[model samples]
Target: MWTKEFFGTDVYHLVSAFVIYSMLGWLVESIYMSFCNRRLTNRGFAKSPFCPIYGFGAIIGYLILHPLDGHFFKLYLLGALMATVFEFLVGNLMLKLFGEIWWDYKDKPCNYKGIICLESTIAWGFYAVIIIVFLHSKIIGFIDSWSFSMGSRVCSLILAIVTIDYIIQLSKAFGIDIRERCADKYESFKARWY
Candidate 1:
């Protein structure tokens, strides 16, 4: 697969990892946000239950921090640094592209321009240790259980859904009313389900 050639992993493995991590990230963030705000919040750029930043961070940690696995302290420190950098970049990119930051750490102690903070970076270190040393093997094992063809097909379908959601969200960011344009069908579907 192209992912194998480019990322040194099969399509099923890489895409599954991305989608799974993204969903988990969304769940975590949504729960945290809902608790903080005392109301439910869907914490993601896309309307779908996926956070691409988390997926990218997980992949980067899997590839980069795997080498430091046995060195606990080193792994923690490096993971913190890596994740902080990634967070800073993504945060800034969103600000530049959308004239808004999806998350702000200004209220946090030791924050840098509200883009990154010390506490979050420290938590990221622990997260790296837990995910790499504890959770990753199980996640990989679960992914491995699925047949390649079936897993790839499912991943493809999910990617398509996420991509469409992303495009819709991007359009909204640019002041395009895609749902408004499709209001009849959208309302009908919502009325049926909700």
Candidate 2:
């Protein structure tokens, strides 16, 4: 079908993993933040309702921790360190590129450049154990059950939509407010009604 293998793994399955993990991560973050802030916040870099960081992190975690699936103690300890490094790098990269910090942990204890904190890193370890023990098998099986042809087609569709959303969000960063006109219209309509 498409060009070829995506870094050895089948492109379809890889993308499926991204979409699944991103969606689940987004849901969890949104729900958790809603309770913490007492308001809805769609936490992610993209306009679409998923965080690629979580997707990438989950994939990376799965790759590294899957082999140690039954060993919770080692898995948790190593996973925490790996995830902390990943989180720090991603945070720093985003800050440099966007001229904004997506998150700040400076207020928390044992933080580094507001990119990460001890508590969060330990929490990542807990998440790693859960993913390795509970989610990895189910997600892998679900993706494997899909025929490549069918799976690729579906992955292509979802990836296309996500790519477009990413482009739009990038444009917004460059003073291209694609959403401005629609938002203004909505405000006027609301004013007239209420």
Best by lDDT: 1
Candidate 2, poorest ten consecutive residues by summed lDDT: 1-10
Model 2: lDDT equals: 0.85
Question: Candidate 1 overall Cα lDDT vs. reference?
Answer: 0.88
Instruction: For each of the candidates, give the backbone clash count.
Output: 0, 0
Worst 10 residues of 1 by lDDT: 1-10
lDDT of 2 by residue, 44-151 (tens): 768677788888999878877788989999999999999999998888888888887788889999999899999899999999998889987788799889887887
lDDT of 2 at 117: 99
The C-alpha TM-scores of every prediction are: 0.88, 0.82
Off by over 4 Å in 2: 1-9, 176-194
For every candidate in turn, the CA RMSD to the true structure comes to: 6.0, 7.4
Q: List the residue pairs that clash in candidate 2.
A: none
